[model samples]
Target: MEPWPFDTITPEEIDALTDEEKQGLDAAVAAYIGECLRRRGVDPAPPTSTPA
Candidate 1:
């Protein structure tokens, strides 16, 4: 995925993003957080569901 398009964004700027842009931003952030977790030896996967 391409890097975030802007260095920084204001709330208004985020609010103005097109739907596709918002999806891209969300993906970029998720990817970045996953990488950080991996670097710290943490599993990035979602926790397994427990039986009720």
Candidate 2:
């Protein structure tokens, strides 16, 4: 969690994003979290089991 932490963002907030913005946000957040987890020697969380 750097620029935008998960606890600070909500599903409703993401739903407010346009499709293109949403995709970019998703990538940025995923990468940020992945780095954080790696630094902690932990695995990143798996993706959603089903599409929203």
RMSD of 2: 5.8
Q: Estimate, for each residue in 1-52, the C-alpha lDDT of model 2 and write its tens digit.
A: 4555468778789889898897787788788989999999998779876234
Per-candidate clashes come to 0, 0
Candidate whose lDDT is highest: 2
lDDT of 1 by residue, 21-40 (tens): 88788778878988999999
Q: Where does model 1 exceed 4 Å of error?
A: 1-8, 45-52
Stretch of 10 with least lDDT, candidate 1: 43-52
Prediction 2 TM-score vs. true: 0.59
lDDT of 2 at 36: 95
Error of 1 at 6 (Å): 13
Residue 31, candidate 2: alpha-carbon lDDT: 89
Cα miss at 28, model 2 (Å)? Answer: 0.3
